[model samples]
Target chain A: MTIIANAPYDFTSNDRQEDFRGAMLVYVGWARHMMFASPYCWPLPPDMPFGALVEGPMAQAFAQHPDWEQADWSTATWTRNGEPFTPDLSKSLADNGLSHKDSLMFTTPGLDGIGGMGF
Target chain B: MDIAVTKKKLGLKERYALMTRGLGWEPTYQSVDDVFPMDSFEGIKIHDWDAWEDPFRLTMDAYWKYQAEKERKLYAILDAFAQGNGHLTLSDARYINTVKLFINGLAPLEYMSHRGFAHIGRQFRGVGPRVACMMQSLDEMRHAQTQVHAISNYNRYYDGMANFRHHHTYLPYLQVPRSFFEDAASGGPFEFITAIGFAFEYVLTNLVFVPFISGAAYNGDMGAMTFGFSAQSDEARHMTLGLEVIKFMLEQDPDNLPIVQKWLNKWTWRGVRVLTLVAMMQDYMLPKRVMSWAEAWEIYFEENCGALFRDLARYGIVMPPCVEQVRKERDHLSHMAWCQFYQARGTNNFHVWLPSKEDMDWLSAKYPETFDQYYRPRFEYWAKMEEEGTPFEAATPPQQCQVCQIPTIFPVAGDPLTRAEHSCTHDGERFHFCSQWCQEIFEDEPEKYVQAKLGAHELYKGNLFGDADPTAEDFDPMAAAMAFLKLTPEDSGLHSDSRDAANFDLWRGLAKANEA
Candidate 1:
């Protein structure tokens, strides 16, 4: 279980402050942690607790970035199958029905109202 | 009584004029723009219609006579192969899956090519390009018919060969190639030429035809080899048309370069994406391999097209933007795509098998960097599972790309094991794509691609296999899916490893007997 990171545009990395932008990022082959990214991003590990996924490397990557740290996390919305994600950060993504072949999206409030970075 | 009449033969220039310009007439009542309204809509500016050149200079009579002769020769070979029991001469019955793929996937596209070219032939104002399109239309028809006639021998004894035309339209996997050609056919004339003639024929035809024909030769599929051989000259002509048309368009107006470049980028990626079937066939399906998929890509595409791009730089045409990803993924695409096929073989018309130890060794030799490390273990896992009496099949269909309609099996960058997923937010509904190129293709024209009937998406909506129709009483989704695929228990059904399994056992038995 590995995932490849292919972004069609240049976006700041969630965990790494390094500017990651290209049509293809890196071949993330054969990994146990897999999730789906839409509008161009990488799949994250679904087995990890939702809190770790949000507050862990992913959130840290987006949080400490020079340009993106100003974004407010309180206005974020996560949904699975059109239902809003519950704030029970203790549950693993797999426990919440975010498995391989399933699609999930996370969006924070943005000026455009379509929200901030989502996938 | 012998009657002698002084008959004069038409000179080459005179014959060309009479055949092309002689046959065409300007509309007396309508403006030329009204007569050829569809050609200009794509924003390609053709300043001079007469500037479009036809190198072949073929006329209707000559085209018919030459094509008739080609058909005659091809049919003779087909008949001889059938009467001589050529099926027994093949490397193995498993080898026919390659043939099945060609018939089921590519042959119908030839017919579509004919229809597309015919549409363009009628629409273009230039007699030269128009005649060339007409000739290509005829060539495509011949290619399609010859491919069917050649492979018709297999339909005689095989189960899956019976209903390919039906499968091509309705089957989920087939939507990959079907939607590609259908998109081309529905475009304006200039875009149509760029899509088929320039992008497909000029750039990628060799990648598709060469491997299959070489495999046919290596595997002793003489009937298929003959048809492939007969179709080569026409392919060459089509390639010429492709190159010529691109040059013509670029040279016609400076404004045309960007439009042609856009089509070049889009169709080049689309054409290569459609060749996933060929990639799988070359790597996994062929019993006696002719060449590794990577090697073929290097020799045919990387080396040749690199030079082609350098030549086109003068006209502001660069290599396709997707070429880098294509080169990087060459080692992985076949393995990833084949794994998907192996998982979904129950739904496919072909059989699947794990690489034999010898075949694995060959793969290791061919793919020194990646095969043993990444792909081999996956095959071994399946082989061991099969040995343990618990075979693997995906419980559900994989997510499909909205534009290409292929399963999203491509590996993510920096990680080959974890599959990469890409999508775009269009109309507030998230649409998934297989790659950046496919995503851009959809984004460039959202209206055309938004309506894609992806197999996985359709299954989710219960539209697959006519399940969307609530009025039909017997439209059980499962039963309808099976019925539409023509996969009955006794008739056209699933192909498995039993044939190879039996052959291996027989070989071992013969070896033991000789030793004893």
Candidate 2:
């Protein structure tokens, strides 16, 4: 499936982790929350605690959703890059095995979005 | 005494052969491989350049006469539309946003097509295709110009219409189409023809053009409708060239079938991703809808392309595997794409708004199986939020697919609620895709896609804001990004709140008073 080229095609990926200047790109999706359109991508320090992300950026990202107020993060189920996982609140993103460009989807079992229609 | 001699005129076939095939000569001064080095590199084998059947018998002299005539008629209409204050005659200011999308997103691709054709026209060893590509190159250039001339009248009275050329380069959402053309233009000659010619022009052009043109007609836009009419003949030639190039490649050698098939798969998925914008426009942007995106897909893609693939089947080319996924998505593509645009409206050059009750009813009727059940509820919730003065806006940019450059807004096939997410790590770096099709395209050409300048990635990295320091403590990144994209505050936000809407009301009121 290699590209047919006259010469060898080689280059560095444009968005490699080092290009972020000390921040790692992480994507967060609130599962069943179609209201948000798609997963939000942000650049954050890998050493930042997972709880801080949920409290700071992730909370702000989903604050407009009506179900955000009713959702309990502690009881939420999580998947990292489509695999099930549990995050220790105190653990840094790096400690929780979250790498650059890795996507995390969280679902609050009780909060199924507005009108329970998965919005 | 003489000889009075009258020379007989050349017949159509003779003139075509003399004008096309007669133009080529054996390269004795330079080796043929040295002159046409690009043709062989893509692994397509052409045993005889002479075997290429000229699709159109158009000569340069006749081409100039025909195109000049089209331009003359088109410009006359454009001038009349302007003098007649045609911008005031549009059904609504919301319809202008669709034109904005066209000028910003699609017109620039026409220019890119011009460049691609011009490049490949010289690269092909066959004189017949060379002549065909050269004509198509001129046609594309003319299309780009006429479109700009047509929409330039709207630019005077609209906010988003201004800065289209700039937006095509830097606008985040526009990168979907920008990158699609760039991907095609950067490929080899065969891949370029197959990607833009066979896949985009032949298979998908109707979906893109029919909606915009018919929407223009339905929405009372004479300028855009006239431009559409002007371009229709050129599009027919381009489609014929598309089919001709594909058949020529396949018929030339058996080895080309698999290569062409691979490209068909890749470009079909790629073209579909780019058309998500057009789908959204058909469904949401047009005030007086011509047809629903689902209906357009059923007609343009499902029916027309279905027949085309069947025709191609005898040449051992089956439908692209991605067609199944596209069928699953046909019902929901526009809804999802419009939702994405609506949520991220602040960042886009064009304005977005919640569909009216009537519009929602139209959507319900159009998309019986999914619209009311899946999309209407979401729109209703957003409308409620807008009523409460807390309209939902995405706080951060969505992750973009590396291949398509579209925000990963597509839902999983047959599953309307969940977003489709696929990613793969190459050389210890992760690249995300909207679906398995995009992932496969990337897997095939990791070398090419890995170098993608993803818009969101660039936004975060501070590369998008030209000469501005994003790291400054007081600097606002979003504002700076907007400045870089040349989008004024008037250019974006809710359609109801936009300056275009305000001006439209004022002018129409004035015109009515004058009539009285």
Candidate 3:
């Protein structure tokens, strides 16, 4: 499958329509379960974490973390229709469009876009 | 419904672009703080208006136009259904007993929701959110009137539909919600929002709408569904408003966090207590089964809310403080509350029979957290014993909860007869409650939420109202209305001397209409 990486916040060269595709990642205040898809992609499973785990034990001892593998690393994929998808259905990054876009925020976490910053 | 008339087919475009933000002129005279007083409590600092986002971009005229069209369709359904022999589809005239409980307990609360939301609509400085609230307020009122009107047709057939206005004064079943909103509306605007908006919408709205409305849909109750789904489409907007309002408050002030959390706890318990009547309705009321409270809670709360809370945790909002305890009690609610109704029905008074075992079993399985484990045995035992004809007598209600107005379902982890536990002293009166959660709420701001509650306080003193209106005395409200309508024995079907079918046709002109 074509993994769409950090789909909600990232951008493309083509400034196409709004990306509600991964907007489920941005909840108002409560955790809500969402099953959604990119405009042309199938819904990605919830396990695939896009951000770094800043705190907790995993941050220190990356080993003893028995059987811990990224969700996308173990998947097999194929296509029946025109689309490609992972068997496990985890995180994905769709094809980059042509030169039409606004500034992307997922990459530049330090810059809040208005200039202040999120990270 | 006359399919052409419903606004759903017309698909009103959300017009907020024009009526809300579109109509909002820049407030040159007043600063943002002057216009919207509630902002600035959340620690998160934002200097730009663009940071505020409205997910449902609704406009005012779109709301009114669609809502108006929805009402017209509902009224037409009531008219056409009544004009036909729609009453025959009912399982029995006795079934209206459930509808009577509905009119008395739920109908008026809709109006209160409307009034409360109107206040919110005007208060929020943000045009997008305010307009959403305005639309919700309008829908709430429509829901109230439509419910009363839609059920009024059954008045001619059922013994109980006419008595809602009177029975509510003494009926424990009806008093549950009445006592609740009376307290909610009487309190401060914030308290009302916490009570009705956040508590009712965020927590309890699904319990009523999903089970109750779905039952109406499954039971061939067309007018009811048109009314419910039409109102519910707007209800999601209210839910959005609730989530937005709470988040907006928390985002504006960090100190508001602790305060809002307390309310989340208080209102959740209060609202759950008030919904006991709905629980009874689910487990025992409908002739055709719908989802049980446990199942509804599983899907709406465990799944939907579980996800919602986890997302909120990232932003620092916690679930209602005592949610785990609430989670544990879902199974107990349906059986116990329905027992209350069955008890009320025993005296040849008001109540509905339980749905078929199939519905009960479905509920048990779907709500594994509640039914399949803890509550299922009780259902199975009751079913088996009931088949052998054991007397199921009405148990006297425990002393009314001082705040929420239902019997304390709060179980003692150890003792049973204590009727739950409480030791909160408010103004020298050591208040008793059904659970630790409720007691904490009473203690937190006794003056605000608890002091004004009229629990079992005034009932023994002989001051229940509604008998004063001559209109309130009949056993069937629609029949009473027909008496006022002077439609003769034929139209007032409850008259002992019901006219023969042929004569009735002549009098009401049913034959001529058929020919036309």
True contacts kept of each: 0.02, 0.77, 0.00
How well does candidate 2 match the true structure, expressed as C-alpha RMSD?
Answer: 1.6
Q: Report the lDDT of model 3 for residue B468.
A: 33
TM-score of each: 0.79, 0.98, 0.63
Report the poorest 10 consecutive residues by lDDT, candidate 3 chain B.
B489-498
Taking the tens digit of each residue's C-alpha lDDT, what string does model 3 give over B193-268?
A: 6567666776677767767878876766776667777777777777776777667656765666765676666777
lDDT score, candidate 3, position B28: 90
Candidate 3: list runs displaced more than 4 Å.
Answer: A1-119, B1-18, B25-51, B92-95, B163-172, B186-191, B344-349, B352-397, B413-419, B453-455, B465-516
Query: Regarding lDDT, does 1 or 2 come out ahead?
Result: 2
For model 3, what is the alpha-carbon lDDT of residue B101? 65
Residue-level lDDT tens digits of model 1 in B180-294: 9988876778888888986678656687778768788899888988898788769889988888888898898999998888888999899888877788888888889889888
Global Cα RMSD, each model: 11.0, 1.6, 24.8
Residue B488 of model 2 has an lDDT of 87
Assess candidate 1 and give its lDDT. 0.71
Per-residue CA lDDT of model 1 for A2-107, tens digit only, reads 1111223323212121211211111111122112211112334556676666565454333322224544556756554334565456887667655333344445
